[model samples]
Target: MELSELPSFDFESIIKSAVKKKDTHPVMDLPVDYEEFNLTSEFDRDSITAFVKSGGWAVGGYLEKRGVMYSAPRYADGRNIHMGIDIWAKAGEPVYAVLDGVVAYSTFQNDEGNYGGTLILKHMVEGQEIYALYGHLSKESLELHINGEKKKKGEVVGWLGEESENGNWPTHLHYQLCIEDPGEPDMPGVVAKENLIPARERYPDPRILLGDIY
Candidate 1:
């Protein structure tokens, strides 16, 4: 049987409900201040790295229309709409869990332009099951926990990866929240223009969980 489409979500409501249950932990150990970058086709890895280095820490918004950066030959049909939030900071920066969850997947994707060392945690918000994918992490992160391992809020989950280990891109964290199960360690961080609506339905903005960092 063909799979039915997933239901849409009111992310704002979900975020409020989750936050009301308990306070969240800091995902990265950086200060509350963050410099936001709006990436476009003109921006490349070198330019972006330079920007981050000069500022110390930066963030990329969810669902931003970007090009070239996600233009690798591996991506077919010009998947330029970003589906996750990109947190840019120094390599080896420790990442923590924002809420109670279980380790769903921890694996290193060796393919070029892939997530590389990635982790996905299963969470519950208002009795609704959701998944959080943390990409571009250090290989060591894969060993931080086994499948089904439970993690508490504010607990150290893993650290950011170096460029060499993080999908061959500049060091950063690709954080995404999916209402539907990805069923694996990986999910598309960008989608084709035509899939934007469904993609948005499937992956809500991560900022809802991360709090105000812009």
Candidate 2:
């Protein structure tokens, strides 16, 4: 069956209600089209920086790493845990959108230990207002993003930054998906394992819609 003919579901309602009441500087990745990814090793090249900076790299297959769902960023309420999949890329390299959308929120939320600069875009994917997040960027990028700016897929929004500028980590984009509303522009992306349930439910699995990481 054609993608256009796929049966519909109630996911749209869930997305609409969430958008109506969401959070600060909120806007809210894939790689430059999500060509491929390898998690077994550290991603150093622009093709892989996030993993080298953080603990894990991009998953090579379609699904998230085993046990990641229960993991902090991925676990339901685990704040420190993983929420969205990581895209390992190099610093200073231009970051591009996997699809088109409106810039919901962007800023230099320097309060946290990390996430020096962040950008959030709201895309109407499959008729749902899916929020995409980009964090750990060069200071210059934050100063340039204007709210409500419309960007097309594959457009270069900003470049990755050095470890010092990118929250003291190797240059890479810390991308994530959110539905619960961050409450603020720079709200915590990851949390301790204790808060996993709400985080999971509020931030439903983006993998459900993003197929084939590699």
Candidate 3:
């Protein structure tokens, strides 16, 4: 859908409502010793995995402008602005729901640089609908639940996919949020420089829900 066609909302209000209804269930059982990884440049999978191992775990912040990592021929459109927070951990780490929601869509996208096995959940915060997209999940995750299934906050949803399953990236969870329903299991987790403004509007900073992990 065109960026112009996407619905707008009082993002602040939605965030406030979500905060008021905060569920402490972590999306992942991250370690207290976790550090943040700077993935703003191209790096091989081994490097990221090594970093994660060194830190016990690690996270990649949102909106980190990158280049070679997102360069073509995989990302042919020059989408280098990361719109999600990546939680780096060992492969097969279980992921949980951060909020109570209904499964909206699920699919396995096998293309390179894609989300691979993905799931999008629809949430209602004070009557305003929002979406959370879980990307780079294991192929087995697709069989864990069906579309329209209900998930409670903190419930086990899936696991981190292996490199062969998770679009050839290091083991991690690409967690993103949508102020408006993306209408699909997948949404653009990265965008070109020119689209940053609209992309920010559609995809708000997940930190509001994730809290100060940076």
TM-score versus the correct structure, for each prediction: 0.90, 0.61, 0.89
By the lDDT metric, which is better: model 2 or model 3?
3
lDDT of 3 by residue, 22-98 (tens): 75468899877787787666666677777655546888758787766764356887788889999998888999988
Candidates ranked by TM-score: 1, 3, 2
Which lDDT tens digits does candidate 1 get at residues 1-214?
A: 1112334467757665677667888789776676777886466788766755565788876777786576566786788778899899878889999899999988998677888789999988877787999999999988888999999999988888887888787778999989878988888899887777778888887877887666
Best by TM-score: 1
Pull out the clashing pairs in model 1. none
Name the lDDT value of residue 155 in candidate 3. 90
Residue 93's lDDT within candidate 2 is: 60
Residue 164, model 3: lDDT of 86
Q: Which stretches of candidate 1 lie over 4 Å from their true place?
A: 1-11, 51-55
Name the regions of candidate 2 deviating beyond 4 angstroms: 1-79, 180-183, 208-210
- How well is each residue in 1-214 modelled by candidate 2, as lDDT tens digits? 3223333435635654554443212111333443345432343444344444443333332122222323222234433345555555556666766567778888775432467678887777446566777888788887667888898866777777676676655455666766534545654455454555555555554443343344
Better of 1 and 2 by TM-score: 1
Report the error of model 1 at residue 63, Å: 0.8
